[model samples]
Every structure is written in structure tokens, then in C-alpha cells.
Target: MCSGGFAKCLGITLIPLAVVCVLCNILLFFPGGKVVESDHITDEVWYSGGIFGSGVLMIFPALVFLGLKNNDCCGCCGNESCGRRFAMLSSILFATVGLVGAGYSVIVSAVAIDHGPKCLALEDGKSVWTYPFNTNGYLTDSTMWSKCTEPVGVVSWHLALFSVILIMGLIQIALCAVQVINGLLGALCGDCCGCCGGVSMFSYALDS
Candidate 1:
């Protein structure tokens, strides 16, 4: 497949993933699917990692990738093949942006998972909204989840949403990584599959 075609596929795949990440992050604000005071929300939800990092930031690259497949420059100053190559080259920069954004989401989500949920928990015989798990091992210990007294099943809820963000972020990272190489290949070698009169256009672009 032409680099542009592959990029288009990646772009299509990224859109839904980005949307899911955004929704999951938003849901994190309301722990256990119930409305809570702003102060009660987990600190990590405020980071906007999924909303900005994985969602908004990813949209740029996805759109660019989608447009690349139809990039035509018949009336433009440059050769069409050359223009296509340049567009592909430019996509690499956007892909890098995607990489950074997804990486940020992954990091934030992972940290949030490790820290567990902030909920009303017993502290000195008083219930206060706070992170109950001080140790990493709490994730595996279902009995320990009872520490969060106010938001019932909050530990599981927190784990599910953040885990989705983490997985989606990793997928975005992989897709962007693929696009980096694909973009480089597209830049170095004109998109042969999409070129009409094949070798001539590819050769002409290289010769110019």
C-alpha cells in the first residue's frame, strides 16, 4: 500500500481511540459513575492527559494523515509527487506530536493507577477523602479496596477507566510510531502505489 493509504488507515483507527480516551478521562472526574464535589475528584483527572494529550493533540495528526491520501498538486508550483512527499514528511512532525501526547497520557494514567482512588477513608477514626493505598500491592488485594469507604467500589472504577486510558495511550503510541517510519518512507520514496504512470512520476519527482 502507498504510504498515504497506510497513514489514512492509521488516522481512521486513531480517531475512535482518541475519543475513547477523552471520554474515559471525563468519566474519571465522576468516580464510580456518581457526581462528586470538585475537591473529591482524583487529582490526576485534573491533568487533562486524556482530553488534551490523547484526544485534542491526536486530532491534528489524524486529520493530517487522512488528508495526505488525497493530496494533489496539479495546479500548484511543485510536482504532485513532490508535494505528496513533502506532505508525508510533514506528517512525521505531527506524528511526533502524537507520540508526545500519548506518552503523557500513558504516564499520567499509569501514575493514577498506581496511586489508586481518592475517596472517603478512615484516618485516625475519621472518614476523609484521600488516597487509601500507600503501597503498590493494593491493586491485587481486593480486600484492601474497602479502604475507600465513601465511593463504593471506587478502587475498581478507578482502575477500569485509567486502565482504558493507559491501554489506548499505548495503542496511540504504537500507531504514531508506525506513522513516523511510514512518513519517513513516504518522504524518502514517493508514494509509488498511488502514482499514475508509476515510475515516470516517481523518477520525475526525484529528478527535480
Candidate 2:
């Protein structure tokens, strides 16, 4: 019973969300993008790039499912009879991946913040900076800056992007759940009420 306008709005919103995720991942690929040094010191602190990258990649599949759901055709694969089932399965799988990826990213970031690099004791009246390490006990690409003086940009951007990814993953999971419920209801109705259930369920699955 959802309105066409509401469905269209939801579809449109997902496009930009997917695009932003892609863009953030792209930015993280470049040097000095995911990890930066403070202007006052040579110390470089790492961000959760690997975790964020994996999370964004995982969420991309969910976006594909959403796009398929929004399509006007019977199914993105062009199979009318079994299209709803296909969409339902895809949504469930991809949403699960997105949720797991986002959750892991958040956890890794928290750990990185907790064990971040600390400044070493002053040597000959000058404070020595230290480089951050990852969970693997290896040094990250991030190193001390010799000339840079600006505060680390990765801290703010990394947190903001991951927060967005987490929120979007939650939303995707809710939508996928609705799709599953609608599909189940439609199947039950079709069995009891004949063609009525099949038609309504198929349409609901697509619109959702």
C-alpha cells in the first residue's frame, strides 16, 4: 500500500548515499588522505582505512540491491516469475555484509584511538614524536611530519565517514527486513487467496 512518491523518494536517496561511500573510499586511497600529521609535531596517527574501505565495499552490494528493488521492471535480472525471491535473497545477504563491515570498522577505530601513539620524552630540550602502530604490531604508512603543522585531518573525516556508513548500514538492514516480511506475507496470502497474494506480494517486493 505504499505510495509511488514514497518509493521514488527512497530510491533517489539511496543513489547519493552509495555515491558518497564510493567517494570516501576513493579519497582514502591517496597519500596523506587517510592519515595526516599535526602541524606542531612530526607524529603521524593512523586511521581505520582498511576497515572503512572494507565496510564501504561491503555496503556497495546493498546499494545494488536497493537499485534493483527500485527498478520499474519486474526484476533487474529480467526474470518476472522469480524476481521477487531473487531480490529478497540479495537484500538479505548484502545487508548482512554491510552491517558486519560497519560494526568492525567502528570497533577497529575505537581500538586505534585507545592505543594511539604518544609523544616520547624530550631529548636535549626537544620533544620527540612517535609513530602509531596497528593491531598487527607493525608500523603503518603514517610517519612523523617534518614540516607540516596542521592538525590531523584523518581523525575528523574518518570518524564522520564511518558514522555515516554505520547509519546507512542500519537503514539498509531495516529495509531488507521489511522486504523479507512483505515477501513472506505475500507468499502466505497467495497460497490461501490464489492470484491476489502473488500479485500484491510481487508488487510490494518491487516497490519496497
Candidate 3:
């Protein structure tokens, strides 16, 4: 496939993934479907990894990739091949931006998953909202989830949504990494199929 077309596909795939990440992060604020004070929320949610890092930052690169195909003759002294190559070259920068954003989301989501959820739990014979599971072993022990007395299954909720963000962030990272390589190939070779056509036409002219 031509690099431009392939990038367009990558761009389309990123949009929905980014949307999912944003939604997951937003839902993290209201653990177990119950709204809580801003201060009571888990600390990782405030990092905005899914919302700002993967979500918003990814939009720019996606858009740039989508527009690459249309740039076949956009600039560069009216040479369609040069114009396409230039567009592909520029996409490398946007891919780098995507890489940074997705990497940030991945790191934050992983940390949040390890830390567990913040909710009301019994401590010292009193009920207070806090990070009930400080150890990573909570993921394997369902009984430990009972520690969060309030928010109605907050442990599960936190784990599910943050897990989604983590997975999606990893996907975004992979796609952006592919784009980096694709962009380089496109810049160096122009559109693959289009180059074949150009070669054919040049040979035909020589034969004539």
C-alpha cells in the first residue's frame, strides 16, 4: 500500500482509540458511578494522561496523517511526487508528538493500576476515604476489595477503566511508532504505487 494511504488508515484508527482513552479517564473521576469531591479522587487521574496526553495530543498527528494523501500535489514547485514526499517527511514530527503523548498515558495508567483505588475504607474503627490497597497483590485477592466500604465497588471500577486506558495507550504507541517508519519510507521513496506508474511512463516515453 502507498504510504499516504496507510497513514490515513492509522489516523482513522487512532481517533476512536483516543476517544476511548478520554472517556475512560473522565469516568475515573467518578469512581463506581458516584461523584466525589475533587480532593478525594485518585491522584493519577489528575495527571490527565488519558485526557491531555493521549487524547488531545494525539488529535494533531491523526489529522496530519489523514491529510497526507490529499497532499500529492500540494506544494514544492508543482511537483506531485516532491509534494507527497515533503508531506510524509513532515508527518515524522507529528508521529514523534504522538509517541510522547501515548508514552505518558501508558506510564500514568500503569502507576494508577498499581496504586489501586481511593475510596472510603474502615481504618482504626473509623470510615475514611483513602487508598485502601497499597500493595499490588490486591489485583489477585477479591476479598481485599471489600476494604473500600463506600463508592460501591470502587476497586473494580478503578481497575477496569484504568486498564482500558493502559491498553489503549499501548495501541496508540504502536501505531505512532509504525507511522514514524512509514513516514520515513514515504519521504525517501514517494508513494510506492505512484512511483511504479511514474517509472512505467518514463520507460514508455523512451520506447516511443
Candidate 4:
């Protein structure tokens, strides 16, 4: 019973996670929003594809979480077994997608932290110091160049967005885990009280 309430709380947390994922995806589509520059021929295609793919992947689990939240109660579909099965299947799917997205986000953030600053180096020995979205108009000016060494420790918009993605991804992973446990409880327990028994068993298993 308590586990169900915890799962419900977890589902509610995913609402904000979904919103942030959508916002990040939208921002990534704009010009100069990516960590890598788009001018290079070969690198352009690779970076563009990767950015778009990651953005798409990040949204999937968020949507799944939203769906789970919307259909949280049993008997909504008028069949207990059917509803339990659906919840189980959805939780499995969410867990799979959340794992992949979280892994991708972690890798992307690591790469960005490792290589993002290096990508700003221009051909004329100057580096462009622009943020992810460049909301301050710095990227609009052509003369916003400085020695790369001078801008150490400055956080860009891309990094900020990546950090948000990483946090959301982790939260999504945790929520999906809880959902899986809930689904399993519903599956093992035929009646409402059975769910409480399942939760007790689950908690005992954890405590052991």
C-alpha cells in the first residue's frame, strides 16, 4: 500500500521531467544550440544526427511515464487482469527506454564535458565563446572571439541543458524501477489486499 503511494509520487515527479526533456529537444533544433559547430562537412552530419537522436530518445520514457500516471488506477479498463498486464508491459517498456536514454545522456554529458570546449576553436586562432542557446545575443556578433584559455570554467548553455537531461534521465530511471515493482505486485496479487501482501514481501526482500 505504501509502495503504491510512493509509486504514485514518483509518477507525478515525471511530469516535470517530461517538460524539461521537451524543452531541451526544442532548444537543440535551433542554430548554434548544439555543442558542436555545424560548419564542418563530415562532423556536421554526425553531430546533427546524434543530437536529434538523443533528443528523441530522451522524450520517449517521459511520455511513457506520463501515460502511466494517467492510467494509475486499476479497473479503469473494466478488467483487472487486462489492466495489470497493461501496466506490466508499460513498465517494462518504460524501464528499457529509460535505461537507454539515461545511458545516452550520461555518455553525451561526458563527451560534452570532455570535448565541447575544444570544438569552439576557429581557424584563425580565435575561439567562439557562445552558450548553448545564446540567449544573450553573444553569438549574433561576429567579433565575440577570445583566447580559449581566458574562458576556463565558464558554463555554456549546452552544458546546462545536458546537466538537466542527466538529472531527468536518472529520475526517469528511478521512477521506472518503482513502476516495475508496482506492476509486479499487481500481477502477483489477485485482489486489492493481495497487493498489500506483495508490497510487504517486496519490502521484506529489500530489507533482507
TM-score (C-alpha) between model 4 and the true structure: 0.55
lDDT of 1 at 34: 89
**Among these predicted structures, which one has the highest lDDT?**
3
> Which residue runs does candidate 2 get wrong by more than 4 Å?
1-15, 21-59, 70-81, 112-125, 131-208
Residues 28-139 of candidate 2 have per-residue lDDT tens digits of: 4332342433432222113443335334544454455446434434654676435544444444455455445544544543444444333333444665544333242322
Question: If scored against the real structure, what TM-score would every candidate get?
Answer: 0.91, 0.45, 0.91, 0.55
lDDT of 4 by residue, 1-208 (tens): 4333444565566666656765664454332343334442112223432333334554565455445533534764788555645654566666566566656655655455334333334444555543232233333432432322323323354455555666666676666666666656544652242656787889999999
Scanning candidate 2 in windows of ten residues, the lowest lDDT window is 141-150
Please rank every candidate by lDDT, starting with the best. Answer: 3, 1, 4, 2
Cα lDDT listed for each candidate: 0.90, 0.43, 0.91, 0.50
Cand. 2 Cα-lDDT: 0.43
Question: Higher lDDT: candidate 1 or 4?
Answer: 1
lDDT of 4 at 48: 30
Task: Please list all clashing residue pairs in model 1, or write none if there are none.
Answer: none
Candidate 3 lDDT tens digits, 1-208:
6899899999999999999999999999998999899988999999989998899999999999998988865668988889999899999999999999999999999999999988989988999888878799999999999999889988899999999999999999999999999999999988674666777889999999
